[model samples]
Target chain A: MKKINLVLFFLAALVAFVVNAQPPRPAPTPNDTLNSTKVLKDGRVMFSIYAPKASQVTLSGDFLKEYKPIQLVKNDIGVWSYTSDAVTPDVYSYDFVVDGVKTLDPKNVLLKEGENGYSNYFEVSGPESAYASIQNVPHGNLQKVWFFSKVTGKMTRFHVYTPPGYEKMKGKLPVLYLQHGGGDNDASWSTVGRANFIMDNLYAARKAVPMIVVMPMGHPGAGFFMNPGIDEDPYYKQMFDEIMPLVAEKFRALTDRYHTAYAGLSMGGLQAMNMALFSPQRFGYVLPLSTGYFPPQIKLLEEKYADALRNPEINKLKLFWICMGGQKDIAYQNGLNCNALFDKFGIKYEKANYDAGHTFITWRHNLEEFAPKLFK
Target chain B: MKKINLVLFFLAALVAFVVNAQPPRPAPTPNDTLNSTKVLKDGRVMFSIYAPKASQVTLSGDFLKEYKPIQLVKNDIGVWSYTSDAVTPDVYSYDFVVDGVKTLDPKNVLLKEGENGYSNYFEVSGPESAYASIQNVPHGNLQKVWFFSKVTGKMTRFHVYTPPGYEKMKGKLPVLYLQHGGGDNDASWSTVGRANFIMDNLYAARKAVPMIVVMPMGHPGAGFFMNPGIDEDPYYKQMFDEIMPLVAEKFRALTDRYHTAYAGLSMGGLQAMNMALFSPQRFGYVLPLSTGYFPPQIKLLEEKYADALRNPEINKLKLFWICMGGQKDIAYQNGLNCNALFDKFGIKYEKANYDAGHTFITWRHNLEEFAPKLFK
Candidate 1:
């Protein structure tokens, strides 16, 4: 018995030695470092990049504001990292310039198409970010719908945001026809503006009524809205004829003008104004955020229907809200000129202003304020 | 009169000279060279990266095959450009190694998240790439749907692809519960696999029936399906209970098992196998592409359902399809082992093998072959 026990003990010791000596599970590669854009508990962000051979890497972003690009310090493991100063609570675009080559954050998956190229974006959460942040509230569902457009003679796509329990809801819900800015498509509102999250948070707080928001592609063809003929605009004709009918049939949406609202930003805002002016009885509320009537548009509106602005039918509108960023915005003067024209025509309208330039931040705040006052 | 004519001529010349000498439009900046990953007409790709200060730049991609990284020549404008050999028609992921740091193509908006990191992707169109290529056929719509999952206790998202005219279709449509690989989410099928294009092409050619493809988030909680107990898997329970019911109610999906098919790749394939075994009558067709049973998984299945393999329910499955790449694939042996086990149990299954290794190319071919055989 002693001899057998001795042999077993030696065998077990050899097996244990082999298991323990099996080369430290291979050291982690440089990519193993999960040091990417991490939001700190204090609301500051920590950005990191693993570039072992890079001589220099600097971080630049709109969140830096007027400040210069922040330089990162390299650690012994060749991962450069930088903890930002407490940033304001909002979504911000950022990029890294590695040895004069401007590139996006490798670790950040969320990207937005900017004037230049695609930039990585992150949301810094705080009290002010509640509207855009993912809260404990019940969330809505977004559907990407593709429909054939007779006006454009091509298949077009749009995004629809249905509120929580929309499927099982008892009756038809009111609709908000939202549109995106100049260079953006229908996806911009939800992806960049966080429109769904904002609506969910507001509905959870009882600050906004439950409604379906439809974001259609504003620029169907080339050349923005510079296409000379108003009737020939593909998106405009499609919205009324094809899009609205499809939305009503496919979704449980209220078709009455009293249950309808229209809002947009920049070029989309211009389109919204045109849509409302062309069909005044289609929408009860018209909101043009961060955009207003230019000289040519105002002249055309005056030429077409000067009495509509002064008549009781216009007064029958639930709300005519206009909002823009601060005076620094390029469109601020246009907003003021349009307001003056409304004043001259004795048209009652509500106005709101924010202290920021023309950006998604301004548009999001505008939506938060504008949505609450709609369909009352 | 001669003197006045001379003066006018001089004025005209001066104005023309001023217009011509407009400072050469200030030299193009690095960002102005929007020339990264351009596909030439002859099926070759031209890759350019703006790394003015970098010492070295090279293009690396699967398209290069066994060749070394293609060295890029820098032009006087500080942009590095390289024209690759005529590549075979397929979508390829690539990255630029600038000064030894691997980075994605900054100008390419299309990206795919691999096991390593995010990589830029470009399509090479040709006859062989028909299933993945965008043809003139009527396209389907992709919807991103979010629903609450009681198993995970979180709002999980999935992507649904509805074929052309699905909205106006008269009857319930068959559903394919497609799942992505380990590192990918619900969007992988549409974005990376080009599943929508594949279905559109197949349907246009009358090679496949019209159906809805639903891709759910397979990895519900933490880890990559390695959380020990298989019965306690969050995604497995969610798919049968919450996901199926929600999809059935929201979309026009046929709830019968005869119309239902299950398919996935790699880790997803493992999960599909688990689901089919757990509820043998739930899916009429089972497709495990580029993945199959390993020793441990086979042992677990044997312990749980040794008699199920010999039973008639699994044998009644409409199709038991197994596909993998050539011998070069790491999972080829796994496929063989699983096949041998099936043979021993007298189970019938269809097998397909391609010449390529483990990649999206192999998976795409497998899907093209497998989809036509489903819901027959």
Candidate 2:
């Protein structure tokens, strides 16, 4: 009787924590009642913030073509707001510029972490966004792995996405070294880029292969990207000397050329192209999104890699795909120049235009399209 | 040879992308030039924000008792500023209240994510903080694991911390099911609580047994805690029916009672206490930090578990440690009452006073002290 009662007591205690405790709540203020973002039924997004004493407020976001600041009107209660026109279905980063200062939405907890700062993000939901949206599909695991970097002389962190059923998988899986843009870090691809969700959706639909994606920090710190030239970059050394070996040693990744891929957006895209070109035997697929080499860099590339360009082995890569966010992409001219250089060297490749602009929306679309063609 | 030159070109491209890509920078405004937070040489921290138009600005943080908002002085440049006296070495969360609105520091990127909102945090370095600070020690991996919960009826995510060398370890490790307080989520313990860094430091010093720590979302959504009572709480059902089994299956966790422990803060603390008492044989170590059962709940506990309370096997557990943040803790009275009840029941346990209030600072100290004694 005592044992049975003890069992019942334990079961009750196990479940009781959630029910019993009442934490003290902060004194409610007038500002606490204001909703910061509202997604209307018609697809428009209305953003609001309470700052009665402010003289000026404006909204700055990536949804705008050039990140133009839109003025917000203040109401009688000192609440400033702006309702945007029906936006396309996608996730976009934004911030409020109040009296010349960049400010995050106080009401929105979801943030897009960048290298130097952070901004808030919201999704305009629709069928088009279903690929990257959190759905009913089995989810993957995103791990924040920190390792000491010999190249950087500091602890470097990276996000690794292991697909669903990874823990119980029977064998080693193909690997994709996915990277973010110049200003973003390891967290960008998984959070703002929604890479894991995209992969989860694709895998659930049987449109993409199950793989492990490693998203490493692109730049070491602020202004790290400003130092021109590949030889001068610490990430270059870190990738080959530290990151790759660490991933291979830590994860059950298939490191052979036929099972490996490299891909990135913008600056990351450039890195991807370089890795495939430099170590032609290491990767089966290469996808560079919304990025290309300058004409001078292309000329230097032709002069420097003439032998590798002419080598028949360079053609053995399963895919050398170039993706762009159409003509509005900032790197369109550079991409065209780089493609011309690829053509001049008789390099065979596939290119696609996914969207408009050098942003996550385009990159998400690029991944959605390019991922299905990999590891075949 | 064209092949060799192509290889060199690829190498150049791979390394060059980091060098060559110039992402467009946002036009710098006057607000961009001001530093938001400056940790002084004397340990006093100065915070500044460019908000020329705002009439009033105040700082709200956990460092202050009862979270009193500190008023900031506006200078000629319309910059609002505040200088805090030397703070003891610890991490603290803060936010700027502009006029009537709660705002984030535009200059600080590191944020502590909560269930409903986000706040920025800063660290004051000292010997006391060394244990939780990032040191030159082998780090562990923090993974965001999402799984479908039949109990919650949705996709539930939890943060799992696998200790250093876990991948190469030969045997299954003991598991600590750690939880955060109300209004916090799975990310809080790793971010603000510094649970990973604490474990890393402890492991490096050989003071604690290496183990896996799982921080699950304590509440499903907003106000889920207000529903009151164990039978009605979804998390109670979710914890036993789904989360525990999922962790054991996915992670290399030893499911035996001796290999399991439960700990939590505030509401989570109450839950931990319940788990240990309810299922006395399941967890060898039980820690409830800054929390206790209220008088009414104590009456229920006594009435519901009278037979189990009399059972002697409860005394066989290795450790039942209770921790509090001294008298200033919100739950101090309830903790005292709960202790009296434990004494009346002749339950053996150790208790510690770690700090002065109900916050992460106290919890961090409590974890640092309690972890070394686990799985012994």
Candidate 3:
């Protein structure tokens, strides 16, 4: 009788367990992930920019038809996105023509230099990719890029132009981080100015001193640094985070005030000045061609740069080349004021003036003239 | 009865003569009509390269995206022609990206200064639908151009940049006819160079002397009178027969030398020298930005310019400004040689050697500087 009662109790417990087993956890859903990581069988990369307000969104670039718009599809995030099929491996230029305005993709991390402003760059996974391996050119291997930054949301893109035979070469080449202005990305100097050809020609002719050039994009209205007024433009965030990490990761750049350097034109010039004054420990040389540094917020730029101006280490700057074209009256006048301030601050600097105004001619000439002065 | 029979026979013979009247000249077929008045409708423009035995041909320009392998359709005239409706309205800079290499169009009579050689230009029709109509702004007017030419096959392209208050206000504006180098159309100056903006800004700032500027594109590849390498390039015959005569008929231009003018850079400079020397009565002022009238075949340039070179009617010539940049070794050397030759020849010429190269900066500056000197 006692065994039978115990068996009855066990049976009741088993019955309850069977009735109350929690519903199997729901399988993972695509909507559950915020940042979608999708890999296609063919290997195309995809991302979406959610803008419910944008009536029309088209992806345009070196990838698609020249300036023709690429239409995007809508999703739950109110963001529009599209994925391209596995593209050939090469540096591709692209931009988002949102509505009628040209813009860079907000979601994609890669970017290139604009002819004058900033452009977007894409990397595709494929067997015949030139970008996959450092091209087997007869000379040097491309310096692999890597870095960590606090600015540009973290890892940022940067490239180095190593002199031919830098790998086989015994000595370090002088470094010139040539930057592109706003609306430009990393590839601008090479594409628009044909920097590679220029460098090649100069080196071939033995006219230009051998050097490693670093081209970075300096757009105020980019990523987290976006703003109309200069001081408000938060490129400082990128300067700290993205740019540095990549610089450190890529080429074996010299780590001295004089050995390390920065130079840019227009927005690029402003970037050079910001890098020069804000981080005296990192750079000794600064050539601002047709540009000057202002706190992205003018008031703040002046105030902060003022503090930098008074710093003792600032005087250690090897070269503060503030150059502009005579025709660029606005920039020239502004640059003149900056040069006068540099003089007042006793900053060792040189000012070179070209006959023309805010133009690439002046910038190219400035590079040719000023680059040779570094690490000499 | 005899009289009636004779009369009937006479009527019958006359009727037969009238009925058998020589078949009315076969109504000219529509195809022949179209060939005569080619409207360029299907919206496609033809780029013809007359290479008798070339295996392949292609057309390239800023118009074609990437200048892809545009296959050329052949003609019985041994002309390799390619048609395109792919370009947009505006001055597009391009070249014939022929088989594995780049070449200029053999048919289009337009050119511009490029990296090593001149680039080609093609114009897409504007919105006005009157082919191309000048847009009249508060400060200036872009005129509709039509001209009869003897240089390129038949009708040629030309545009005039006129300053504000010209139609209503009756003062002769010093005319400055700026020509593209070679391979570019008249629209090149307007599109890529933004000639209108340059003038508007200069004039608005009261920096430039207000004047009517004309851009005409017509140059043969042969001699002082034609192409420098006439035999080497096949387009020489087409250019001489078509492009020039049309420009002279299109716009209202000043007839006097002082009121009229001429200037260009590179091949354009060659054209400017050729035009002023060959057609001396048309241009009082000549500014060859970066050119030398010396192509072994330019005996005509020498012959025509010989009188102007010695005891030059300096006062009548207005201003013969010839200048280049200091760094353009080739151009500077050529310019310097010309200066010396001109000096030996007792030619009173105005010249400048700026600290730059034979690039657009120097050329732009040359144009900017020369404009103020015209009819001033």
Chain A TM-scores of each predicted structure, in the order given, are 0.80, 0.89, 0.56
Whole-model lDDT per candidate: 0.73, 0.79, 0.51
* Candidate 2 chain B: 10-residue stretch with minimal lDDT: B1-10
What's the TM-score of each model vs. the native? 0.84, 0.90, 0.33
lDDT of 2 at B241: 83
> What does candidate 2's lDDT look like per residue over A249-338, in tens digits?
888888898898889877788787776666667789988888887656676778776776676756888999998888877677778978
Candidate order by TM-score, decreasing, is 2, 1, 3
TM-score of chain A of 3: 0.56
For model 3, the stretches where C-alpha displacement exceeds 4 angstroms are A1-156, A171-174, A205-209, A220-234, A293-305, B1-376
Considering the two chains of model 1, state its CAPRI-style docking category: incorrect
What is each candidate's fraction of native interface contacts (fnat)? 0.25, 0.52, 0.00
Measured against the true two-chain complex, the DockQ scores of the candidates, in the order shown, are 0.18, 0.32, 0.00
lDDT of 2 by residue, B208-250 (tens): 9999999999986434352214465777778888888989888
- lDDT string, candidate 1, B1-376, tens digits: 1111122233333334544743312234775656787889887888998877777888766576542467899998778989888888888767787765667676777766443346677887778887888666776777777766778777668888889777568989999989887767787777767888898889988888989999898778775562213576777778888889988987789988889999987767777666555665888998877676655666665676677667777777888788887775556776787788888888888888876655577777787888888778
